[model samples]
Target: MIVRTIRADDYPGLNRLHASVGWPQRSPDGWRWLADNPARREIGAPEGWVLVDAADRPCAMLGNLIQRFVLDGRSLYGATGFSIIVPPQHKGASRPLIQAFLDQPGVFAHYTLNANARSASLYGRLGLRPWPEQTHALKLSWTIDPLACLHGRLLRRAYGRVSAEAAETMGERLMNRRLWRPGPLRLPHGVVDIRDVSDSSPYGRFWGTLSEQGALIADRGAEMMRWRLADPDLPRRPLLLGRVEDGRLTGTALAMTAKTSIIDPPSLEIIDLQGLPGFDAIPLLARTLIRNARGLGAAKVRLQALTPDLLSRLGDLARSARREGGWGHGHAAFSDEAVAASWSPTPLDGDYLMCNRPVPPAAERQWARRRAQASRASKA
Candidate 1:
């Protein structure tokens, strides 16, 4: 088998392989993003590799992304998405693709992938130790709750009532089509008022701002967000914008209509969920969403969450697969189920502050001490 970097001409083959293997293959927008991405050349197809049989046939392929993030006051990089397209039975061809990934020096301190136990064993054999990680899924079989459906209707009416013109303009600008309604639901305790992704005030601005920070790793700007959120291919995907009374975006959730393996009916899966510091609304959100999905005549609501908070909160819902973080600009799949099911803590060298290990306890204490001193000095 020939394991090597993928070329520009190799996209079709790679795409085909991913499709055959039942992976969430790239879309046209993703393809465009990859082609024009500055990281394409650096990490080899955005830290991806392709393997070919001696006949030069594309036998197996995998892609990895390295991302930089701050965790526990330290900078770290995480390597993720070690996607393999070759069937598990093709042991010879598959080994090289993963081997090529590990061969890179200092390329990853930790690594992750969305593989089941069988595939995970291969990673363990290759020196990629497993961390406690998870992915979650929700089966949308329950009928939509009448009350929740009414609430969504009321939210939409309230939004429209705010100004038919504003609603119309936003619909055109954001292409929002979720059946939302303004409500006075007796929300549970700590159930903060979740702002609609369409809320035009501080919520929208906050989202744009946070997205900008996330985009800095890449060279793109507003155009990137537009491309990501408004990709024509991702229709019926609700982009939620929410905030608390303190004007902080407490929770940002997005749901997209899609099919699932667990259920036969259509369902809306949460692609992403972002909450403010110390606020974990995923379980509540998941429960609410499940109720809502039943109300929507769907079977389930699935969410992919990888944050530390959700990982701990919904640990029980975790699947057997392991998911590593990846670098590059792509759609953020934030869902409670996905988070619960497939979150791995493999650290790429550049993605997290403590990518290699949970920040050593001593280091964390020292950092905390210094931070406290700095705060005291500022007050003095």
Candidate 2:
């Protein structure tokens, strides 16, 4: 078998490999997005590396996303592995694919989120040290009935209709709970207004301002926002909220409905949150997300606070919104000690924000049409 960087033409084979492992198949738009992404070229490789047999059939693939940041007064690089697939026949391909990723230069660190025990052991042997601090800081919103949630999970595993109804009911109850609801939209005396904005709005400005005041954060400027938020295959459009005072954007937050394997009901994930020095806008932002999530029928709101300061502030905000602290983990590995020490990663840093959901028949047809149009355009 030969291991090599994946190219656009390899997506069909990759999709087949993904299916063989029971992973969600990528939409045609997803494959196109991967092909067109500039980061692929920036990393001097495609979205991943694939191992192919003598007949040129792909047997394994490791996918990643490269994110650049300024850490400790210098430019730093990181890549997060999003997917690794190897079938029983291709078991031998895993090591070589991982080794090729490790050999890539210029990346100061490699990160993975929510790795299973077996994968963790393999990564540990390959020099990836787990950063537990990042893993321990997740905050959860809304109260859930554990038994109901469990029933939903079991039903879903068996592909039962009751699962959908149960999940929806659980979501509605979680949102309708008085504890999860903030009485009204109330801003402090200085805060002039709170409202929704487009993801491509001036929120990037607020992100930049906060980056200057806080620790090193992944680049989430206009370009990154467009690339990440505008994916057509995304199950839900990100909700963007902003706080303004005297016509200046003081704070911003972005949330999306996401499905997780471990969680029975879908969740509203807070992927990005930025506020001015006092963190005055966080509580309001949290309230708005909870309210909107209720409309989206999401069971909970999830937040990741990477730094101690953000963690404390978010914890307080969650408490104000009557949210509970739950056990969730985020993991990272670094090549440079200093960069790793200063680095702060949010759920938005990598492909973690992209959650797979079952597509409705109508949506699937729409995607099929779009795929045909894209193929025609490409051939032209």
Candidate 3:
């Protein structure tokens, strides 16, 4: 077996590997963006790594998205692992594939979301200690109908198009009627306005203020905002809402709606929320997001609290919201134990939202064709 950095020519092989493992093939445009984007390359090179057998055919691959972060008044680097693919025949090859990336220089740390129990165990043996902070996904609404929710759950189990459609319709009607109206947003004196804006809109001053405060945070400047929000493959175009006081930007939040299955109602998720230190703006932002999501037909609103201060404020408003924890581990190169412990990562830090996008019609057709071909190939 051989492991090497991915090259431009390896795009086809990578896609083939992904398909062979029953994953969707990325659009050509999306692949090129990942491979050639200057913003991504500015942090590191060669995308990620691929493992091949003696014949030079890829058996497994691991892709990384390196991101710049600020910690302890200094710049730090981190990477989020995504699209990890390994066929059943080469299941044992997974550990070595990840080990190769961890061995690379400047990698500091790596994180992933929703890893299986098996993978979690493997990561533990590699000396990555789980961060102690709890990553919560809170639901903002409490008006779901028991009957409709039960009906949708059963329909999902039946797994038919007609049943699925019925479930969604029922959910929509139930949620739309039960919507709870929050009080108007009350900003402190001198706070002028809050409204939605495009990702490319200027807010450098707002971000600079947050960065200067020295909390461990990923860079959320214009470059990252444009790259992440404008990606062609994003499931939904995130709402970039900001708070302005006296004509200067003070805070911003990115929210989007998602529904994974017929049984699940659409959820509004706050992927990133930031404001100046000591600024009591997140609560008002949360209220506005809940109202907007309700109007947009989402059944619930969710967000992760990245700091103790934000968590405390949100806890008061979303008292009935469900909470859960997330797991992560890292190495010293990324940051010292203290810095790593202080780091707070939201769902946006991983590829969670990216993977939730709706499949394009063309891609769906292509997937059906590929499945048919595979079925025939197996029988032959």
Candidate 4:
């Protein structure tokens, strides 16, 4: 039973393990990005960890170390997409393998991962606790339909003008905004390209940078957003993307509707919202989203507070009610990881105040059941 750092060459085997466990396939480019990501090397968990049985077969693996967290002005590390993919015969190997995985130096520092309640318990054993928080998906209620709201022709023209140079610059600017201080961005009306439209655009790039840089971290990103947009299994959840103007994508939103209960009005989740320098557009972006929600017959929209800005600005939108705070314990060789730290969490007193909403107990229980099921299934 050996637990060790996976090398770059192990990617294919890791990919195979993830696929065999009902996970999606990964492209070479994406996998390479994960392998070479700066955060992993800085924290000393570069390849995350792969557990091999005595014979040295790669029985299980966790994909990437996706987040860097800043708590009280210091940074912490968290793993996103961490998994153990032991074959059915080796299912029972997970417990010890996970224990060994965590024993790896720097493995637990500021690491945050979202699991069902049961997994949370496993984390507890490892000194990782649930950050008392509830994530909400907000669907804005808009007075207009999505089709009517589009200035499509204008956007197409705008996307056309976006050169790779512009893309790179906007991308870099957004990266700066997330990692450094926030300020107004001055942009000529024509230079931005909001076309890729989802978080993969400047905004998604910001969140990814945030996680990778140690500001804020999450368990998922671009791939999940891309997948959600095309997810066929979840029939109730329809996908939509919007840009403030053609190239300047100010916001991105996603919604999931339930099939069991029409009376169980569809719920919309604002997966990620990124506002450009002119912050005024953020409110408008919020409003447009709500209008879209109303069109879909959603009961109420849910939104997660990625940073303090959303909580502060939308804190008073008439329908904007406070949701519960999500909390977690993260640790990292803060000093060692600082060099690679690209971002930090917004000050607690800043516009980053997160509100907590009630998480239905039943929902929590259901989620726990599902997580336990996933854990058990993985073991099987």
Candidate 5:
């Protein structure tokens, strides 16, 4: 087998690699963005590296998400990996591919968010340690549709017992509602659905300050934000609730629907929450998300891996669901432990595909057509 830089023409082989592992096909545009996007090349990093067999057939592929990072007052680059796959017959192909990602020059850090638990020993040996516990250790969640929550659980016969107990003892919605009563927001104009993320807008201005905090963080400026919002595999657009004042963002929250497996219930997730320190609009966005979750008919809303400051501002808004330990491992190549611990990791900080279950664009289009036909029939 020979390892080489991934080329734009490798999309088909990569899809085949994913299919061999029982995973669904990824979006063509999305795959191109990872392995052939201008962002990767502009940073002077390989698009990605691939391992091919003797017949020139690609057997394994590991894609890269390389981006600029600011750490301890120094401007540098960081690399986070995505779409790593190797068939059983190929055996031990993961280490070399991962090493190739880390081996690049001018990189300050190398981390991954979707690595499996079985890779813990291997990752440890590769010098990629677990990320801080501030976000990864605990998960907090809120229930928007208690009936639907209880209903889906009952079908799974798994987490349903807890819901059944809550139903019997506390009554549905009582515990969640009493924790915090969030009212509609209006800081001079209430919260607005962030319709524009142009660099001159408040959304872009907000990330500008965050990136300069002089800590370990992914590029969150307009360019990357725009790329994420245009996710080719996203089922729909994510909701961004913002409170702006005098052309600056005071606070904002972004919510998206994600599922790791087909068996998982539809989840409305709060993935990014930060703004002018001490801004009080988090609960307002939380309220809006819960309201929206109901509108979308989602079962449960989740708060995943937010920074400590962002998490604290919510203040008992959601119950602690479970502990999510160590899906990430990396060490800072330039900065120290203090800088590494400061990174506010959301799914946004890593591959968007980490939490997203890719639904082929064709399938999505077909579903839209069916909905339109149903609407026409109803009018008739």
Candidate 6:
């Protein structure tokens, strides 16, 4: 077998490979974001690399997602692996594929999120290790809608005794007994307002301000924010909320809509939460997130890999994944020890933010039409 860079043509075969192992694959357009991304182009990183058999069919593959960050006033480049696969028949191809990814230059660090047991061991052998902080291994969750969060997990056991509908009714009544409305608190001053991505003017100089205080932070400037949200294949269109006070954004967050998996109901996953230091904007930001999530019919609001300061600001609803156990784990390898020590990894740092949701059928056709028009204009 020969190794080669991934191309647009390999999407179908890649999908086939995904199916062979019960993993979800994306449509051709869905796969385009990896290669067509402005960050990848600027950094000169390949979309991915694949090992092809003698017949020129891909047997194994490893995709690289590039990201840019700022650390202590210096810029840093990083790559995260995605959709890495090596079929059981081609066991030997695994290390080679991973090595190929590791060989990529101009990267200050490499990481992967939510690695399974098998993959974790493989990645460990190749020099990647989980984050040093115990917090990065914890999946801190906050229930936005108690009734919904209880349905499949806590309330399911009572189903054989009482009907699901009856159980739900009882749950609602139990919740109603307490006046737990955070509306008045989150808006103690009513200064916070909800705005669409078009009205993201407050974020104009947000990144510069943030990098001054934070040693390691993912780049989320105005243009980068627009690009990140513009990915056509993203599961749900993430809600970008900002805490606007005194005519500028005091705090902001990206609430990603998670359609959900087998046991849990749908939820609003907070990818990253940022706030200016002076006053605590997190509560206000959290309140806004919960309100919007409730309006959108989400069961819970979950945030993973929280920094210590951020975790402390999250008042109440602070529970681990299963009330005790954890489902979050971070794998990383950084060249600079000081940078690694200073790093407070958030969910935004890896491809998990983009691929967490189950892959749905591609429907964002406008991106294609727009690209075609641009192409035509360029040729003309």
Best-fitting candidate, scored by lDDT = 6
- Model 3 misplaced regions, further than 4 Å: 16-24, 37-39, 53-55, 71-73, 113-118, 135-202, 261-264, 304-309, 324-335, 359-380
Poorest 10 consecutive residues of model 5 by lDDT?
171-180
Tens-digit lDDT string for candidate 1 (230-277): 433333334343334354555544444443211123444554445444
Best first by TM-score, ranked: 6, 5, 2, 3, 1, 4
Over the full model, what C-alpha lDDT does candidate 2 score relative to the true structure?
0.61
Q: Model 1: how large is the Cα RMSD against the reference?
A: 19.4
In terms of lDDT, model 4 sits at: 0.42
Better of 4 and 5 by TM-score: 5
TM-scores of all predicted structures: 0.54, 0.74, 0.73, 0.46, 0.76, 0.76
lDDT over C-alpha atoms for residue 200 of model 1: 62
Off by over 4 Å in 5: 22-24, 36-38, 71-74, 133-135, 145-189, 212-214, 245-247, 318-341, 353-355, 358-380
For candidate 5, the lDDT comes to 0.63
Candidate 6 local distance difference test against the native: 0.67
- At residue 147, what lDDT does model 2 achieve? 54
Candidate 5, residue 63: Cα displacement in angstroms equals 1.5
User: Ten-residue segment with the worst summed lDDT in candidate 3?
Assistant: 172-181
Candidate 1 stretches greater than 4 Å from native: 22-29, 35-47, 71-76, 105-109, 133-233, 260-267, 278-284, 295-297, 304-308, 311-380
Q: Tell me which of candidates 2 and 4 scores higher on TM-score.
A: 2
- lDDT per residue (tens digit) for residues 80-137 in model 3: 6777787778777778777876776675566664354447667667655544234332
RMSD to the hidden true structure, all candidates: 19.4, 9.5, 8.7, 17.0, 8.3, 11.6
C-alpha local distance difference test of each model: 0.43, 0.61, 0.60, 0.42, 0.63, 0.67
What local lDDT does model 1 show for residue 79? 50
Q: Give me the runs in candidate 6 sitting further than 4 Å from their true place.
A: 19-24, 91-93, 144-200, 260-264, 315-328, 358-380
Q: In model 3, how large is the Cα lDDT of residue 86?
A: 78
Residue lDDT tens for model 2, 155-250: 567753333334433232112222222244333454433232345455656655766754666766566666766677765466666777666677
List of clashing residue pairs for candidate 2: 135-330
List model 4 lDDT by residue over 1-380, tens digit each.
Answer: 67676776777777778556434344565466555544455676655667776777677765445344443345555543355466767665656655655555553343332333334455566554433222222213322223322332244455543443453332211011111121222233322323353654665664443344333332235544444234332323234444445544444443332211111223344544444444444455455556555444433455433334455555456245444323332222233444424322211111111111112223334445666887999999
